[model samples]
Target: MSCSGFQPISLEKPTPEDEELSDKLMEKVRSVGGFDSEETKESKGAVLLKLDQIAKEFTELLSSAMSSTEQVSGECHIKILTSGLHGLGVPTNKPDIDVLFVGSRLVSRLRFFSLFYIMLRRKEGVKDTNAAPDAFVPVIRATVDNVEVDIVFAGFPSKDIIPGTLELRDDNILKGLDMESVRSLNWCRVNAEILHLVPEVDNFRNTLRAILVWAKRRGIYSSCLGFLGRMSYAILVAKICQLYPHALPSDLIKAFFELFSKWKWSWQCPVLLKPSTENWEFGDLAWDPRDNPKDRAHVMPIVYPIHPHINSTFNVTESSLQIMKKEFNEGFKVVSEVHNNEACWSKIFEEFKFFDEFQHFMVVTASAADDGRFRRWVGMVQSKIRNLVNFLEPRNCISSIRVNTEHFSPVSETNKYVRRWFVGLVSQRPLRAKDLRSPIDKFKSMTVLQARRVGFYTEDMKLEAAYVDRHQVEDMRKENSHFGAPTLSNTAAVGTGEQPSTSSVAEKTCQYDETTLPIPPKVRKTE
Candidate 1:
């Protein structure tokens, strides 16, 4: 049951020149705070070792629990499926660990999830165990020894017993499985698919590491924030490798920016692999633009290389698409500059200049009673902020809405749990009457609606909206030195790419209910 068809190609040790390039890339990534230093790597390894121990302890305990329950009959297998193991993980400041508990008959997800939650609760130093059963991707997230761990369960039929050494690459493994099971498997499957699709593994990994840093520094990395997520980023990089199979890592890196910079996403989606009709055996829809009308709706589709073959970048909005296009062009220009003797890698991964770009901004703050509540509440609100931007963009009143994409904690010790997010607003014209008030009211209502959806809206849990000018934002940043520049202008399009307004931009505007106005989703979902 080990990796059946996909075996990683072994390579000789990196030569001196390769080492030099690797060091340079690592330095560049480290400069941007993403490089995994030796000490950090050892610490992460220790965390994984501890996680493995916990996984083994939990599996044994679960087995005992199942044995006592008359419904449990067969053995359960525990497997660790980490993005890091598949070489897809970038050396980010925070590393995520995923564990899958594959069970056989009588072990329902609810039962398994409940038992694991109980087990983790009883275990020493396992804190903040939240088993979200009704979530879109139901998972049990907890902190074990201060390392974040996400746990999910996959149960096979009564006759089916998953081996400990099982690899999910087999299509038969997925047959008759539910969407959640498919999702659990995809944690590892997508990485495998990306790695296999690329021509050279090292070339892909190093190139991806560089791109990851660039994306983070430039503030367009959040998939939930309507930008490319890890999966989409991986596939796009793999596609570059597919295009230039024999290119070195450095060349591939440059070509990646160059190719995607000029990519006509409006005309054709970026798909690394074609949709296989045979893949539908598992009842998941294969991504076929011709067959699935929904697929055509993706503004900048980066189709998943596996079944349930949907666009991973479907969360990208028209505005985010425009921002990404600008980034690609900027990235290419930076890389090209480095190609000349004029620049270094740091120039490509430079921190974004966000705060100085706009005159007005809408600052949204989510205050929670505790650290745990703050994390959950702020995350729910942040994910939906793009929806607010999407609502404003097409109305033609607001020129552009840019999300800061970073969260800041309030400076006051009394408000330690308060987290704030800022959205840069570009007014299409001078504010006339309540024109500004309408969009603000709409945004405030949307945030409340989102908080309610997460069941996080409560009396003590407060959501505040305040409009601040550039001077006010600067003062706030000075009060909280840790906060980044409070500007959305970092995402502003470069050059004369039609800056969202005509010369009559100074005209006064009105704010109304606009009941007749159409508002699109933060990102359009394929039907």
Candidate 2:
């Protein structure tokens, strides 16, 4: 399907005045520092520094508190995830710092509870030690350079399958640390690749910026599962990438759908299904699956609801879902059209077949989604799309259309002939500009090279027509201003001197113009 709806709008090219504005914007960037430089840190700088300070202080305080506790054993290891240790390449006004604590067995559990309780406690002073519960672990709040900090702890299993000491070994925690770092690095690399591959960086950036804002507003920044969140999605993607480095995007999407389906019905507890209701018939309920299937179904199992914290972290409202649907539909349409067309696919593959490897990686990972069979089928289709992208990578042309005072005109006959010849040369074998012949041919042919540049001249005539139409409408409105004279058909209030307002005769004149506005085309639905 052709994008006929996207008729090129005739717009005037940037004039000298517009050039001045562009220059000013560029200058502002320079004055602040380059885009990638630290000088232009903006609000992100303050946030990062604050987070770093908070992490250090929190780590130290937790270590000191654990060391003092007689019940605790081993050391503590605290690692800050996200942009706290290394920036994720995006400018953030206030980015969350995810910290993971790997440490002693008993101490880790106690510290985790104590840290959470102390942070939530309403009292200012410490209570009697004897009155504290056996599980109570004291946590002292200390400022490290004035930045606020929060610490959470988790225990690592020892070789004997028992809980380890509070002092977490580097070897035990390395895998998780590496996983987070690798994911962050991959995210940066993927975005950079996108900028390199996509012609319209500004358009892409604008869409991403809008999505980011919407996600933040909805509190769905993380793709964590259980709740509708983005962090879980990201983590899933990262895990897939780790497993299948060459998986295609389509494979990942299909896998996600499959997982969603499986997660929907895997845990079928009636109580979980009905969270609002309470069951208080007995203090404790015993389950005998054979005799009491219904009761068994209501039993709460460990990890019954996977990643329960996700629900609290993300807020996926109806509006957010609608926005995502719109964007996804647009992208799906564009990609599908390019993939299904044999000619386009062949062109893309002719230049870049290696991209298929990436697709394969994505598909492989997606196949691992909860519903294996369904996910596998989805992965297969995604692989096909990736192959299509590879096929069209070369022939696709992108050019900026310009509208000037000059009327529409084709390139000179000689330039056209040269373009056809160059196209033939490149068509035989994919070649960059360095391999091409004739400097003049290459220079002049840029307008018609692989991408054709189409130009139109409607600035003068179109503006004049629009101005005339607008003025005519204004004049007609003025002439009719007094045509509709208002007279009181019924009067509820009248002054003593007012003649009963003449149950006045009123003439309401309505004007109709036979102007037809353009109707937008209907959007197509995906099967």
Candidate 3:
């Protein structure tokens, strides 16, 4: 039987050229650090172990405290299960490891946010700890063993203890859970389902890896900033693998772009691994564009392959959808040519040239008082860059928002706390400074409110946006030449390990404030 959303498109196997292309794609992806090294694997494993240890310690302490405070019948364990790419076994060279703390009914959210968060903050190996208990999906973001880790919480209402053997695949696990827990638990559950539904897990991973590298290089991978996310990319590739069950990675890659490039990504054509079977009680949370205007409005809706079935690409915007479509069509052209000759793989995986492409540009600069505030301030700035893109996208003048997801330090930047992001504001007609006044002003205002909500805003923390042309962009790029490759900040780990910036539902949690591009002053204007 076919494992895809529909029957197999074709059982035809890949030709010799497909094998060659797959091999080349794998090499290119690996060269750009798309896949993990042995050392990275070891480091990531160590971080997971340290995280588990912390969760166990916190649970033990909580169990003791609860026993003393009240009459507890049985001891329930809090299990720390790794999620995201790390848990999915398709992690890149530097995956921001995401782990979920599954607790019992006795363990409340207050304790996890307070006790577990504090414990994580003080843990010897953990550093750069931050928490967002008030966010839509509260999480404790930290780093252990030089690898970023975001610890999310989920407690079962029907269980006294979350034993180690408990499987989240069970639908009842989400019963009586708040929306927050449901979202957090879905992190692991969705990844598990993707792996389960794939016809060939290894092939799916390789195909997805190549696509991820390509998407990153093309600057269309960040869900936080109005682009397809890791989950979306994974599901897209997995679907291709399902359609071509026996196809190799090379064939899957070709099919991916070919099918998606032409597919109408509309409400009538959502990419689903399975049908929207409402078996559980959280139908209200499930995605149904007909009932929910917000869901109906999503330009590119990619449904999660599990219960709740939320649009994994919930953050995608019209501008982003158009931008991604362009890339897909071009990718199809390149990958389809692999049979005749070796496709220009280099062109496919080249670093996005923000300074080269487009005429007018929008420069967003995030400035802080000092090193202590710079990272956090920059993160808040990143979270709202998409809003700016969203607003600008609607204008008739702005054709697309070409954002370079990598971080670039300004040249001759003496503030030591300033980082600049360059965005290619593709406008049809010649653009002037005033043309973007309304959107730029609105974007800055949104940033201010978001910063205040996140409580990271201060007098010294500043966000400034400006409109410039390609000439000015070149000037700024040259000024920052000595700064070398983009800065690899902890925030650069865009969950998928591809983009330097992330957006959307990924940031709805604490990760929201920590993801973007700031503008440089070297190219303020051009005559």
Per-candidate clashes come to 4, 28, 14
Best by TM-score: 3
Candidate 3 regions exceeding 4 Å error are 1-5, 14-21, 342-344, 411-414, 454-456, 478-527
lDDT scores for all predictions?
Answer: 0.61, 0.25, 0.71
Model 1 ranges with Cα > 4 A deviation:
1-23, 68-72, 84-95, 158-161, 275-295, 431-433, 450-456, 481-527
Residue-level lDDT tens digits of model 1 in 1-527: 11112232233344565456556766776666555557656656776677666656655655665556446456655555564222365545554455566666645675555544555655787776665554444566677767666665666764345566665555667777776677666656676777767878877877777777778678887665677765677777787777666665656677777777777775154555544444475332454667567667667777667665656665578888888888888988887776665777778878778787788787888787876666566655665566667766776667777778776776886777777777887886763435556665776786666556545466666777777878878877766636532121111111100111111001111111223222112111110
**lDDT, candidate 2, 121-147, per-residue tens:** 322332211101111111122222222
lDDT of 3 by residue, 98-217 (tens): 788888877778667766676677678777776666555667777786887877788787787676576667677677998778878888888888898888898888888788878877
**Candidate 2, number of clashes:** 28
CA shift of 439, model 3, Å: 0.8
CA RMSD of each candidate after superposition: 11.4, 30.4, 8.5
> lDDT of candidate 3?
0.71
Q: In model 2, what lDDT does residue 222 have?
A: 23
